[model samples]
Target chain A: MAEVVTNLSRKEQVIRMAAELFKEKGYSAASMRDLAQKLGIEAASLYSHIKSKEEILRTLCFDMAAEFRTSLSEVEKQNVSASEKLRLGIIGHVKVMAKDLTASAVFMNEHRHLSQPWLRDFLLLRINYINRFKTIIEQGVSTGDFKKDIDTKLAVMTLFSSLNWMPGWFNPDSTIEPEKLGQQLADMLINGLKQNA
Target chain B: MAEVVTNLSRKEQVIRMAAELFKEKGYSAASMRDLAQKLGIEAASLYSHIKSKEEILRTLCFDMAAEFRTSLSEVEKQNVSASEKLRLGIIGHVKVMAKDLTASAVFMNEHRHLSQPWLRDFLLLRINYINRFKTIIEQGVSTGDFKKDIDTKLAVMTLFSSLNWMPGWFNPDSTIEPEKLGQQLADMLINGLKQNA
Candidate 1:
């Protein structure tokens, strides 16, 4: 049983290593053999943990998408206004990216690399997460919390696009603390960039 | 002479085809033979225009980087306030991405795959562009255009993060015009998502 558990963790490790390689090198370029070598195991030994390279890609993409959804869901439970929800979502997003940069990169950059059925499923999940933000914006507008002229579609796109790409440049050791980082992003999202009266 | 001209065009076509393939299939898996087949030419015929697959990648990545730099520089040339320059720079960026989605995608997503010298040059260009935004934010603070307490680093990061990922979702035909998109984005960057008094 212990061996089985260790084997499972080793499989998880392989998936993670492969996820980084896939995000960096892309799907068609990453190979089982390269992944096996990275893990210090024979290429054939990888079969014990995962069936194929596609499986690894699917796992990484799915897990990242799921994590994003869960994070947003958790944020929703807080007693915040619609605008604050948007802010919390951005904060949650950046935190997740900071915590797991590689996985976030894979989720953002390589979801299309998955095969047909998997791609559809992954996209479905992503679209759902996107809609959560959209609905929040709609609610804000309806309640007079957000500007009526606010293009919810474009606003959501702009907001999420800003938050989604944070992993590419966010360094934890930088001068900004994570808490402050979230606050500024919230400020940017809630208020306009221009100085208020 | 006419045949030679046709041959040159064909060779150029091969390079373009290879770039698309590289972006789609990646560098390693996108074999020269695959490129030749896509171009409906013999693999040997490809050498007249490009020396190797790596050379093609170099050209593609460099040209893409150059386009992004040129866009930013154009904004820099305009005699405007730092805030306005930042807005115009972002507009130029979105327009470039709109014009050349493939090149922009490859440039942003595939730079890490580049060899050392090429990679270094590309990173330098990227840093230059990033600094352009940072300088604008710094100026905004110095001139009292923006709040001094604003974390310029985070401000710049949020600004660019929103702009960098525009191409990923921007649709030229989806209602919002380029100028309007620029204004909205600028509003978000300068003012943020907060409601006004």
Candidate 2:
């Protein structure tokens, strides 16, 4: 676990610890003092790196959104078939979630606690991210890669729900690796979406 | 919407209003007073029908769990192919969620706030429900109707995730109906799981 945090700056470390605290105690219940105590620092020192708990939540949410965009853009750039793009896209999504389990989990579950402009901004980023996935599926549909009658929005939501729900049930200790799980799920979804058996 | 609440007793009406409040404001941020304000009643009167905000949440969680169990049990009793059973099961699950959107959403998101014994009990029911779905898929594999190599747990997680994630996005006014969504999703999943797909 120490290796996971190694080479990170102090601010990065604080955000990481705050993510874990938020995941454990939830965003509303987790206090700045608790986050500081977890890092073996005073509450005053904690504020130097991060302004508030919601700031940590906002960072996690935006960072996860950025990670998804990075993952999708890489897949989008490949000249492979749309089917291949989707499989690769799912694998990339899972990799990001695996890379930072706590931050991603907190991002998934606790972003609802963010208030006002930040919440609006985070949600806009999220919508843009979802639209990116929809774009892939829409391309697939237009290319006759997926079912002709496919509802792109429904398919995208379904695909994402399978991947996004990972944070809730994913076992970091599980023997099944993220890429393998992602590959299998991608295959399953593609089989469903394919124009023909 | 008034007609929706017309048949219920006063206590049942309180729980329904609370579910909407919880869905809108979230469980922690929502208060008994807000619920009363929504219903145009005294906060003290709100207590007469439901003892606490958590009480309404507990009722919703347990009741939704029961609905799922009932849905699954009905599907389980069907004298049909495992594939058909799975399809019916999903349709039933969707109907339950669609029937009471707000309560189902609260059940999905806010059950994390439940206290020890109730939380433990709710989780147990949930695990049992999930396993029941697994059993259906396992039966499909045993019957040679599904991919023998299927990771039943992964397949189940993927399937449930698609349906469970619905509360966050489902539009009651959508032209596409719940049963239709369930059927299409079930078809996609089955295609993914079919041995020869």
Candidate 3:
């Protein structure tokens, strides 16, 4: 058990370093040697831990997807109102992006570099993830919590677009904390910026 | 006059082809030779019309920026309610993206590839563009057309995020006409997606 924990931590370290490099140089331009130089490790040693750069990218994309899926699943199981569920889901998505800015950047930007069957699979996973939001919005409309006229697909797209673009602009040192920002976004999306009578 | 017209038409043809190539192969991997080959002209002849590959990128970015600025200027002159101004601003934005899908895609994706002083200028222009939205939303809040409790900056960011992302997913062939889709987005943003009593 101890040995396995140690090995996993070492792999995690490699992933961390790789994410920064990938984010800075882009996945296509970044090389294993560059990653090793950044890590102060021999290139061969880097290879021993991770099979290839593609593996690292695949891991990052799938891991981020898995984290989202797990979070959404938990949100799904909660016996909360549809609006609450949507809010929690948005918060969960923002928190994930906030937790690892570099990894999230790579996950969002480098998915285009993913090859073959994995590319197709990753896309389907993304669709499924988006559908979760759509389902929540649909439920809200059905329950009369959300505006019935709302285009569910467009609403989901808007929500995801707003949430996904965070890594591009979010500053970790900003005065607005991530959780608070998440709540603010949820409030705006649900209640809008216009005050009602 | 005829000769000048022909020359300008040829230049427009090159820009159009360049936009397509830039969108497909990306700014970095795309080359002058490839662009020339696509146009069935000698690479040197391509130089007679355009200075360099960077010139193409610069032209596309700045041209798109100019279009947005022009549209916003028109929107700014309208004597409408603050909410109406924002709606018009968004519609103008979507219309630009819808009209030139390829150029807009290149403008969004390849802005990072812009070199040196132009890159810095482009970044400033983007900030200026975003500030325009911020200003409109602020006006809405000041006039009580928007909720005072809303965070102006986040609201602007959310609006841009939603509008800017249209290029990534918008299918020109979709049955949803761009004008109607723009109206729908405006409605959602101005009035929260929640059902009101």
Candidate 4:
């Protein structure tokens, strides 16, 4: 039983290693053999854990999706205002990226590598996730908290685009704390870049 | 001489085809042979126009960089206020991305594929371009146009993060004109998202 549990964790280790490889070498270019090599195991041995390169890509993308949806669900349950929800959403999203940079990068950039059925489903999940933000912005507008004239679609795009791109340049070693960075982003998005009009 | 001119145009065509391929297949995964096949030419014939795959990537990235810097310079020359400059900057940036979606995607996503001195130079150019926005935001803060308490670095990150990610989701066929979309984004970024706050 202990050996079985260790094997299961080793399987997870394979996925984690694949995520880093995918992040560094990109999904299409990084072969399963390369992943196996990275793990100091024979190429055939990798099969015991993961099915194929596509499986790894699918796992990374969906796992990250699950992470975001989980966070969004938590935020949705809060009895906070739309503005506060937006703030928490940003923090949740950014923290996920900050904590798992490799998974986030792969999730954002390699979703297209997923094959059909999975690709279609993943894209749907992505759109639904984005719509969550859109719905929040709509709620804010309806409540007179957000500008009614603002394009809600464009606002959501701006917010998600900014949040999604964070993993690309965000450095864990940087002086800026991830939580603080999230707050600043929330402030800018919620308060606008302008001061006193 | 006519043949020579034709050859020159074919070289340009090779670069253009490579841009499309890089956008579709990604930089590292795309082979020169794939580009040649896409162009309906022999792989060896491709050598007459481009030296290597990296050369094509270099051309695309630097070319896009040049396009942006040119636009940024024009925006910089304007005697408008910092806020106006920022609005125009957003418009210019979005327009460029909209006009050349393939090249913009390559530039934004494939720059990491560039190697050596070229990579170093390209990153420097990118930083300088980002600093232009940082300077404008700083000027806004100094002039009390933007929130004084805002972190300038974070502000620049949020702005460029939003702008650079535009190519990923922007659909030229969409109802929103690129200029109008830019205006909406500028309005959101320049004015707070909250209404009547």
Candidate 5:
């Protein structure tokens, strides 16, 4: 599990361990028994904490999505220039990824295993989140903060892809603060979108 | 499969379907028998072309890695400004991804299933590939074609993260040609890195 890096949580041991297991074995292949064995808890005790594997995955996906939504809304509320708003947005997203590296990786990679109504809701949550970004870019362009000619959809995707790949590489104990890392990342992407003086 | 998106191949039917199945079921969970059933062929017939499931994955990862290496070497041979070279390099990569969407998706997602030696070799190939992009950005910086103050490592990673997420969202029947799409992506990224004229 990524160089024996599984002990990523203390109080939330079950959720983190299941995230690691789900990440390792894929959601469908991993059993409650396996998770229980890893946690040294009985399957019945595990059942008390969580209903099913899918429920855990659902919680991670929606909770992370909600965090992102909340972060974006917080950034949007600031009375900053459109460019600064975008920079802060990038930082906010990176902070979310840095806060829970394993869970973020699980959300990014294993969320596909989520079932019907949950999957639909997850997709809706995701699209609405992305749409808010588009609005930010649109406002940035209109205010001359960004290049008027930039493709809003591609730019937003580029911003996300740049920001979302963080968990694949970020170290859990790296000295670089998440906010500073976010600042550098924001500098890179926002500079690309920024209009010339 | 991704919303009934599995019919993504023709001549290389076995490999493509395997990629899809591997993507859906994860390489560990998917079996030779399942692959044979999906292919409408006998198990022996499946073995005649591919020795094992891991062997199929090895071919995908190494072959795609080789393609990327070849593309980088080809771009390096061209005598152009570093920024233009970078743009062409990006186009080369996007064309590779766009050429075989399903296989590329599988390569990105399922390469982790590769065993030890293959995994080590894959990592080396990837780092070397990434290093080439870093050198290009470095040269772009040295030539005063890019911002002198940029973090080269972060900038290269940003370029890759921006490019590597294509399979997640790019439509198989996208109206945008890979080259043109590559052009826009290159413009967005390079402008971010470009020195003020």
Candidate 6:
């Protein structure tokens, strides 16, 4: 069986290889030398494409934050009811994790280690993404599509936590497909098994 | 408010303080001198209580693994049905995260950095605790108590990914109490809101 050729850019290829190293071995444990070796280039050659390991992390975090924001935007554009929007929101969150697990992991785990001004900006983006979800949930509750008792804010946090951590466990090589995983997660979030009247 | 007195041993005290440093700053970034400085002791004097920073990490990992295992054992001892056992199992998992968030963080995040022997022991204990939940889930499904359509192993893993990650989001100061959080998560996992049967 022939392997599928993945057409990655020089920059994109570095990000992919760095993400694997960072995830398998935590950021500090994985070094520039190791990453350079994985890329089949000299350590000095890596600098031509990337400034530092920190930049690689920031790239991953920023790109994921962008993609996540984009997914939410797409969900917002759909002319659907609040409940369907919420379902789509869940789908969007899981799909991001599924499609870009490494970037998602870097965004979720390593962004906390970023320094001051950059960290603040990264956090602002993350909080905005979170609020986007919270607003959708709030709309669902107000529109009578979800239970009145639902704490829209806390529910969003719990839902995001559940969805964000999926990359740590999900294996793309496994039999479970991403869309199916999204649907199962969305079902659990929206209409948990208790029969709705 | 009166200051709460700590009843931890000198060694335990050292480990506790070190864990906070390790958690806030990644393990590689935290130093023995920094740990000793935090404890109000000379760096050389600290070796009397511990061999090195790695030793502190090993002790913390063992403490966390033990706490988790003990909680699972209590769940196992409960004279309840397999489904109820599963609920308690999840509750137990979340409780550990809430109560021992730092140690749990170190165990979950840093154990891979351990030397081979310690890593082997940590993995063994980790698997043992995981198997407890898997067995409970398997029993529940086989008894027709849980939705048999759900893969027991994946469901157990997903449940764990959800619970184990609570520390990243949970705040003790938050209005949501652990008990209520546990109950809500339990409901979401077990019953999922699929219109109440």
Question: What Cα-based lDDT does every candidate model obtain?
Answer: 0.77, 0.86, 0.85, 0.86, 0.83, 0.78
Residues A153-194, candidate 2, lDDT per residue (tens digit)? 888888888888888888999988889988888988898888
Which of candidates 1 and 2 reaches a greater TM-score?
Answer: 2
lDDT of 3 by residue, A1-197 (tens): 99999998999999999999888767766778898998898888997788887999999999998988898898899999888899999988888888888888888877877888999999999999999889998998898877767788889998888888788888888988778988989888877522241
Encode model 5's per-residue lDDT on B87-108: one tens digit a residue: 9999999999888777787788
Which regions of candidate 5 are displaced past 4 Å? A1-11, A28-34, A41-45, B1-11, B29-34, B42-45
Top DockQ model: 2
Q: Chain B TM-score of all predictions, in order?
A: 0.83, 0.92, 0.90, 0.93, 0.89, 0.87
- Between candidates 1 and 6, the lDDT winner: 6
> Which ranges in model 4 have alpha carbons more than 4 Å from their true place?
A174-177, A193-197, B1-5, B193-197
Candidate 6, superposed: residue stretches over 4 Å from native? A1-8, A193-197, B1-8, B174-177, B193-197
Question: What fraction of the correct interface contacts does each predicted structure contain?
Answer: 0.81, 0.58, 0.53, 0.63, 0.67, 0.49
TM-score on B-chain, cand. 5: 0.89
Computed on C-alpha atoms, the DockQ of candidate 3 is 0.46
TM-scores across all candidates? 0.88, 0.92, 0.89, 0.91, 0.89, 0.88
The residue-by-residue lDDT of candidate 1 on A1-197, one tens digit each, is: 99989988888899889877876677777777888888899999999888877888788888878778899999889888887888888778777777778888877877777789898988889889999989988988887788777778877887877787776777757877666787788776677622232
Tens-digit lDDT track for model 1 on B1-197?
99999987876787678767766765666788898899888889888788877777777778877887888878888888877777788778777776766666666666677888888988898888888889988887787777767777777777777776775677646876777787777766666522232
Residue-level error in angstroms, candidate 6, position A168: 1.5
Error of 3 at A78 (Å): 1.1
Q: Give chain A TM for each model in order.
A: 0.90, 0.89, 0.91, 0.93, 0.88, 0.89
The TM-score leader among the candidates is 2
Between prediction 3 and prediction 4, which has the larger DockQ? 4
lDDT value for model 4 = 0.86
Model 3's CAPRI class? acceptable
Give candidate 2's whole-model lDDT. Answer: 0.86
lDDT of 2 by residue, B72-116 (tens): 998898899888899999989999999988888898888888999
> Which has the higher DockQ value, candidate number 4 or candidate number 5?
5
lDDT score for candidate 5 against the true structure:
0.83
